[model samples]
Target chain A: MKMTHKRRDMLVGLSFIAIWIVGFAALTLYPLIKTFIFSFQDVDITVEGIVTTNIKFENYRALFKFDLNFMDLIRMFVEEIFIYVPIIIVFAMMIAVILNQKIRFKGVFRSIFFLPVIIVSGPVVAELFSQGATTLPLIEQYGILDIVTNTFPESISEPLEKMFSEIIFILWMSGVQILIFLAGLQKIDSSIYEAAAIDGASPWEMFWKITLPSLGNLISINILYSVVTLSSFATNDVLRKIRIDMFSPDEGYGYASAEAVIYLIVILLILGLFGVIYLILRKRSVRMS
Target chain B: MITTWHKIKHKLIGRTITEGILYKVFIYLLLTSIGYIFLFPLLFMLSNSLKDIDDLLSPMVIWIPSKIYLTNFQLAFQTLDYFRTFFVGLSVTLLPAVLQTFIASLIGYGFAKFKFPFKNVLLGLVLLTYIIPPQITMISKYVLFTDLGLTNSAWSIIIPASFGQGLNSALFIFIFYQFFRMLPKTLDDAARIDGANRYYIFFKIAIPLSVPAYVTSLLFAFVWYFNETYIAAIFLGGQVPTLQLNLVSFAQSYTALAAANQHFFSINEGVKNASTILAILPMLIMYFVLQKSFVEGIDKTGFAGGE
Candidate 1:
C-alpha cells in the first residue's frame, strides 16, 4: 500500500509539471530553435508555406559589416546598462528605505512612486519625453543644462545631458525595484536591530552590517529584474532597432535573427557578471558573519 | 572631539523629546520631491489636454491655460470607441491572466512538493524562459500562429496561457514555488496520515494557504496582459484595438477622419493628450480602488533568490 502511495505521489507530481513542460517545449523551446535555424537560412513566405535556403554566415557577416549603425547601437546598449542599472538600484534602495521608515501617509508615498508602472505604457510617458516635458521648466529657465554641459567634456556632456533630460523616466523605471527593496526591508527582523542598538551600534554601522548583508538576495533580484526591463523596455533603442531590422525589407528574416542572437548573448553576459558579483558577496558576507 | 560633535548633531537633528519628529520630517522631504517627480507627467498631461490650440501655441501658457477647453475629451472618446475597445481590452487581459495564474500555481506546487525525474532540468528550463526575452521568439511564434490561422484571434494569446506559457508565466511559477516551498511539510504529512488524498490535500489545504500568492500572481499577470502592446498589435492586428494601441494611433486616425471631413475642427496635441488621459482612466480608477491589494500583492509576490 505504501509502495503504491509513493508511486501515486510521483504520478501526481509528474502530471502537474506535464502541462508546463509540454507548453515550454512547444511554445518556447521549439520557437527558439526554429529562430536559431532561420538565422542561417534565407526564409520566404509563400501562399502555401515558408521556404528556406541555407545562407551560412552571410547573415552574421552582414550584421557586423553592412549595418552601419548596428555596432554603435550595440555599444550604446552596453554603456546604458552599466550606467543605468547602478543608478536605478541605488535610487530604488534609497526610496525603499525612506518609504519603509515610520512616517505618516506611507501608502500615499508608495502609490505615487508606483503610479508610473501602471500608466507608463500609455502615450503620456512617450509624449512627455519627446516634447521635453521631462526637462522641467525651472531647470531649462535657469540654463542648468548649459551650465552642466560646459562643466564636462563634449563627449561626456552629451550623454550627461541626455541622462539629465530623462531623470523622470529613470525615476519612473525604479518603481518595481523600490517595491522589491521595501519588501526586503520588511522581511528583516526588528529584534536584530534592537539588539544592535543595545550594543551601541550607530545607524550607519547597522545599515552596512545588518541591513546590507541581509538584503544581498533582494539586491541581486533587483539587479536582474532592472537589467532585463531596461534592455527590453519600449524606449530601448536596441530593441527598437532589432524590431525594425527584423521587418526591414532589406535584411529580412535571417539577418534579424542573427542580430537577435547577438542581443541575447550580450544580455546573458551582463547577467553572468552580476551572478558572479552576487556569489562573491554571498561568500564574503558568510565569512564576515 | 568628533564624538562630541556627533552628540550635538544628534541632539539637534537626530532624536528629540518629541520622538520620531526628525524621522518624520526627513521622510516627508523625501516623499514630496519623489512624489512630485512621479506626478509631474500626469499633471503635464492634464494641463496639455485642457489647453486649446491657441494656448498650446503660446509658449507662456505652459502650466495653466487661459481658458479651459473640454471638447478634446469628447473628441477623444468618440474616436477611441471607448466602450467597445474597453470590453475587448478587459476580456483579453483578464482571461489569460486568470488562466495563467492558476496554471502557474499548479506547476509551482508540483516543483515545490515532490521529486521527479529531470526535475532540475525542468526547473532550469523554467528559469531560462524567465531570462530569455520574448522578442527573440516572437517572429517564429508569429509565423506559427499565422500558419495555424490563429492570427487576428484572441485565442492566439489565450491558448498558450491556458497551458501556463503566457507572458512571464515563468515568474508566476517561480513565485508560487517559493510560496509553496515555504509551507511546512508537516501539513502534507498530517493530511496523508488522516487518509486525505493528494488532490484533496492540494484543493483543501494548499489552495487556501496560498491566497496572497494567488492575489499577487493574478494582479501582475492582469496588468502585464492589459499593457501588452507588441504581441497584441502583432496578433490582433486592426481587428481589436487595445487601450495602449488606441492611444498611439489616435492621432493618425483623427487626422484621417478630419481630412475626410475637409479638415473641419483640426486635430491638435490636446486631443492626443486627452485621448491618452482618457485611455488610462479605467486603469487609474481600478488601481485607486484596489490600491491596498496592489501594493501588498507586489510585496508578497517576489522572493529573494539566494536559495
Candidate 2:
C-alpha cells in the first residue's frame, strides 16, 4: 500500500507483462499456429474423432485440382470486391454527407442507417431487414436481369443489369461503413469548413477537396473492415452446401483446406497491399500540411 | 432579387426557416425527400405486414399492403416457436452478456491501468485478431470446446467469451482503456493510501465510476450476442435455437411464395409478418428505451483517445 515508486513500478510491470504475454499466447498465437498447422494435416471433422497426418503440399494441389475448381473460389472473392467495394464507399460517403448537414431528425437517419451493423444477418432481425424486403422489391419492380435482356441489347445491358441487382443486396450490408463515417464526420473540424466558405468555395467543391481529404483515414479503415466482413459472410449455408456437393473422405479433405488456404493467402496479400497504401496515405497527409 | 445567394448562407450556419416563398418551398421539398428515404423501409415493412395472404404473397406487395391481414401476427409467432424459443434465447443471451462484459472490462482495465512490458505487442495482437475471421476460428474453437465437453452446452459460449477473445470484449478494452485514461489517477492513489488492493480499487473506486461504460457495454453485448450468428448458429444450431436462428424456418418456407410477387408468402403470408413482428418486438422496445445510451456508448468508444 505504501511502497517506493520503483518497487511499485517493478511489481506492476512484471505482473502486467506476464498476463499480457500469457493471454496473447493462449488466446491468439496458439490458435493461429494450431489452425495453420491443421490446414496442412488431414483432420476428420465429421466423425467423433480425427487424425492429423502430414499431407505435405498435397492439400495445396488438390485445391487447384480439376474437380475442386479452386480458381472459382478465388474468383468469388474477386467478383465480390469488384462489384461490392465501390458501391459501399459511394453510398456510405453520400449518406455521411447528408447526415453531416444541418437537418431535422438527424439522429433518426443515423440510427436507421447504422441498424445494419447491429443486425447484419437478415435472419436475426427478420422484422427490420427481411432478406426479401429490399432485394425482392427491387427485383420485382425491375423484374430482375431477365427483364433487361428482354427489353434492351444483350451485350450492353446484360452485365449492367446483373451488377445492379448484386449492388442492391450489398446495400443492406453497409451498416459498419455508416458508423465509421459518422466517426470520421465528427472528427472533421468546423474551422476548416469556415475557412473554405470564406474563400467562396461551393458546397460541391468543399466536399471534393476538404471533406474527402479529411475522411482519408476513416475511409481507409472502413474499406478494410468492409472487405473482411463481406468475405466471411460466405454464409454457413453456402459452406455446408459446398461441402456436401464436394466432400470425399478418402481423399484426405485436402481440396477444401487448399481452397481455404488460397483465400487466406489472397486476404493476406490484400492486407499487405492495404498496409503499404495506408503508410503512403499517412505520409501524404503529413506532407500536405 | 438578391435571394439566391442569401438563402444559401443561412444553411451554412444551420439553415433559416424564414426565407422567400420559393426558397422555403425548395427547402421543404429537399428535406422531405431525404426524410422519405429514411421512412421508406419502415413504411414498406408496415404495409407488407398488413397485406392479406394473397396480396402479401404477390410481388405486387412491393408498394402497399393491398389488403390488410392482422392475423399474420399470430401465425408468424407460432412458426417462430414464440414463447419457448424467446425464453431460451433470452436466458442464454442474458447470462453470457453479463459474463462477457465483466471479463471484457477486466481485460480492458488490466490493459489500461497496468503499465506492462509487451503492452503494445499484446494490443497489436488483439488488433490483428480482428483480421482473423471468426469463421476461420470455428473449427479450432469447435475442437477445443468439444475436447472440453462443452459442445451444445452453455459453457460453450460462456467459456470462450470469458477468455476475452470475443470482438465485443476487445473493442470494450479499447474503449475502456481510453475512458480509464481520462479518469484522474487520484482514485487509485487514494485507494492505495487506504491500503486497498488492486481488486478493491477496481471494484470500489474504478467500477463505480465506470457505470456508463458498464451499462453501455451490457447493452452492446446483449444486443450483439442476442443477434449473433456464427457461434450460436454452428454451436447451438441443433440444441437451442436462438432468436435469430429461429427465423430460418420462415426463410426456407418463404423461398418461393409467389414467384412473380417474390416476397409474397405462399399460403402463410400472415405467419411471416407475425413472425417478423414478434422476433423484432424485443429489439424495438429495447431500442426505444436505451437508444440514446446505446448510440452514445458506441460513439464514445476510443474517441477520447484519438486526440
DockQ of each: 0.59, 0.30
Question: Ten residues in a row with the worst lDDT in model 1 chain B?
Answer: B15-24
**Location of the lowest summed lDDT over 10 successive residues in candidate 2 chain B:** B12-21
lDDT of 2 by residue, A1-289 (tens): 5557756765654553354356456656676566667667776755657667887776666555654444654655565565677788888887777667666777876677665455445464334443444343445576766767778886556545645544434665676576667767887898997897888777777887788887776777676767776666534233433334224665433344444555666777777776687789778866875
Q: What TM-score, to 2 decimals, does candidate 1 have?
A: 0.93
The most accurate candidate by DockQ is 1
User: Pick by TM-score: which candidate is best?
Assistant: 1
lDDT of 1 by residue, B181-282 (tens): 988999999999999987788889999999988987887788778777766776777677777778778778887777776433788778888888898887
Q: Give the per-residue lDDT of model 2 (tens digit) for B130-206.
A: 66666555555666667777778766776656666664556656667767777789988887898888777878888
